[model samples]
Target: MSKLLKFSAETGEKFLTYSLVSVGLGTVIAQVAPHVWFLDNYAGLFQLYKKGFAVEVPSHFETMLSEISDDLAIPVKNPLTRLLTVIGFDTMHFGTTSTTSGCFIGIPVNFNYKSEKDIDKLSIQVGNKSVPWDSKDGIELANSLILSDAAKRFGIAYELSLVDTFKFYLHCFSGPVIVIICGGVNNYFCNIFGLPYRPFPVKGVFYGLLIAFGIGFYYLSKDLITTYYEMQALKNVSKVGEEYITGGLEFYDKLLARNKALRNLLPDGSSEFNTDGDSIYLFRKKHVPITVKKQLLEKELEKLNHSNII
Candidate 1:
């Protein structure tokens, strides 16, 4: 039994330690490692991008989206590319050398894109360093940031419309989903939500949110596991508790019987004991009362089989 308890304690401690360490590591990585953040939350970013590009707009993004859509809506490149890409951005090169900078909300952005293997591995480079066109990790990271940033600016540049509102919702959603695609969620949402228009670093928000989420999840799960174990342990000891209660009742009944037998011998069958506080005292004819405390009775019963009470 001692060995079993030792093992259970060790296991519980280890589980708690592991959970804490994992959450702490995840938070540290999310904060210091931008690439990891991007990879973890890319799914949410993709969803936001889809919402951003679909809204009707008159900005440069709209023009780009339109041309890209036309080329993609009916794929002339391949039967597979019909609904997605007009020309694969993988091979497409853009530079600020009079060929790549595009106007975004009147802001000229150095948007350049390249892909390797296929569209799934497309990379976008802004200025001299975005991500290499061939680096899959770099490309994925860029794709998340670029698409999110572009869509947000496009929403801002265009008139008040469904797109802007959607962008706000996207920002709210993005605040917590920082683990995926390092950066980019809802720039529009962030601006409006923060109001008064202060500059909010998206990456900083991402890291903080990631850390908060990791810690929250770890503690929540640990508490749940601990509760479950406590319940199970109680269930295992239920029989012992029951035995203790039964033993106590039997001891009381025997004591009462013994007292009654003693009194019956007195001809009048009178009681000879009285309860006083936590003690029981016996009355002796022409002598001082002898006393036995309730605790002593319980202790005597307990000594008979210590395990049951335990």
Candidate 2:
């Protein structure tokens, strides 16, 4: 019975010693572990998160637009077409010509007159000639064609802005959290071994848990941060959309006002002017000499090219 008691006491002491040693070692390792390779791989996690956010969010936004367009039976091939359709145009024709200087010039004109009578009565002319085109179908087609194209283009720009915001959030939030977790894990691991020696299976298990805890903490923090920023970005986008719509209305109002003012400058009963505020005035006047402007431009370019101050 005495021998048994001595054996039990010895066993107890050894267990306590082992436990203390293991814990001490674990604490040290946890502090240094983040500098190791496993933590380094966490960078890839951040990269993945960033890339995933970028790919998914924009795709989702586009998908929503596409579905809406499809449901409305709107053509989605060219955003402009979809915009035109939304604005109420049945048919649209758009064409562009390019200059030798690589500039593209586009001429877009919408016609609402469906019948010869409407065309003649409207007195609308294009390029010094009255349009042989007319429609009794009302001006909805022309208005729709113009508005739809504008709207689609605006939508594209909005989508791009959303994408940029998403990317910014991913980089700012996910990236830093991943880096922090990786760094912490490495620091913990390096502290684990005070001396160079092989790690036992049990020690390895504890180390793995420590790393996991660090990584888990980082992920949770990252998720929270990302969500917060995403919400903010979404709110901003909503505001941006509202602003765009309001601005568009204002722009059209100003444009129409300017057109009206110009029309008032024209002579009454002139076929060169239309009630819809379009003008088609042409005069066979001699071209103003371009020599002075050309000379001035040439001198400026020469000065710029030869400037020693850089």
Candidate 3:
């Protein structure tokens, strides 16, 4: 019997360790693989390029001002363009560039609209470097800035719109996706050679299938091995608690029974019985009186209350 008990204990420990190892390995693989392959390096590069392009509008503005001033003697140098350029350069150095910069920079500058009737009244402050220009004539100024006659003829708003769209895709989405795909493929290949891992041609499909199977097993009648053990431990503790409660109740019930028996033995009209706090066993005679019968009942009640019966 002792040998059987020892063998069972050893087997249980080994099984528990194996289960822990499997769960630990699976969790580490799932969490680390995705971030290392697709999320970190690829996402990081996309963010860097976006930051580099965040001050693209300000740069474009500077170029337009330089070109327009050269042709029309307007002296349109924008201080805002210099500040934005410095900010963009600093962000690129820090490696903290992302899509958020575009929103922050673009939204502030484009907040107000240019009214058609008040085009002459609209003036943009470039910086201390250049004079503010009437925004009503911004299209013509933009056109003058362009080197290509065809491009200049099309108007500044058209050119700016096209440039803005191109920058958005290059900085925000396309650049990031391309970088992510390249890094993911490279990492996947590296993992095959470096780790105890094999290459899967249809990894996405297989991963989906594995996840579905795991979920089904967790939800369906199949064993929830870890949860089952936890429940079993709780059940054991509940059983111990119930035993203690039952034992306490049984003791209380026996005490009540003994008290009732003592009350029955007491004389109905006796002075001892009439008073609440009086001990019926205290009135002792050399010969057992009818009151002595009550004393014996009291003694039995005390014994039952003190003894472990249940």
Candidate 4:
């Protein structure tokens, strides 16, 4: 009822919706009328932010990013480390000695050539430790996060909308075709303000307001859309993080189990590391990096605990 209708964090308030409507209306007018400057501005804006976000980085990124990177093994030399170097994350390489890696769009991720051996060669450094990856999950998680970040940075899903390509088809190509054929026929019948009835400098005041509004829309949209997606992405990452942790623990279990079987059967003094010592694999790479979603992991673990307790 009122709660649903109320302007709140959940809804990005009414202003965002209103701004979207206004912006959408303005864009439509720019297309139909195809007023040169208006259309040009719309097209330019779309081209600029076509990838669902503007090019700016977020401010509070370090805090949340730290939460993500905490104990998340990165290569001693990794692109991710390079990307976050300004914020005190300075590492090198996302791959092994023969492995090649690079960053794209500011995301510290390795290039995926779709080769298993190449990917498996990738390892990240956590403190003095090296954690290796075998699966594509880390890269996948990075892609979602990168896109979400772009959206958050730019303030719209224009990057997600893939609308710039559509604009090329609908406006850049078709708009001209329609304008040309219509112009030719109109010349014979009517003279609409000599040629090309420009709207700017006439309705510039109104058009200027819409452009101004669009700027605000960009900011708010980033705030709203990013707020929502960040939550969901974090939830997914948390689940993956849990799996990554569990796998590591299980890998340790395997080593312990094997050693236990060997130790008990070996009678008096027939062991390599030590007769009574706990077998700890120091050099062996156990699990890949785990990127956690802070709050989501708590909630997830809570649910599991509740079920077990019941």
List TM-score per model, in order.
Answer: 0.18, 0.25, 0.17, 0.25
Query: How good is model 1 by TM-score?
Result: 0.18
Q: Rank the candidates by lDDT, best first.
A: 2, 4, 1, 3
lDDT of 4 at 35: 26
* Candidate 2, backbone clash total: 37
* Lowest summed lDDT window (length 10), candidate 2: 96-105
lDDT of 1 at 138: 43
TM-score, structure 3 vs. true: 0.17
Mind giving the per-residue lDDT tens digits that candidate 1 earns over 1-310?
Answer: 3686556545644664465455445555643243222422331222212323522223445455444334223221221111111121111111111111211111112122222232332232233334344455343333432323333322222211111122222322332343232212223334456411323365356446745665454444444443343333222222233343233333333334434333433333353433321113242122111122224334544654686457
36, model 4: CA deviation in Å?
31
Whole-model Cα lDDT per candidate? Answer: 0.32, 0.36, 0.32, 0.33
Cα lDDT tens digits, model 3, 41-82, are 332432322334642344555465355334332222221111
For model 1, state the Cα shift of residue 230 in Å.
Answer: 0.7
Cα misplacement distance, residue 127 of candidate 2 (Å): 59
lDDT of 2 at 141: 23
What's the lDDT for candidate 4?
A: 0.33
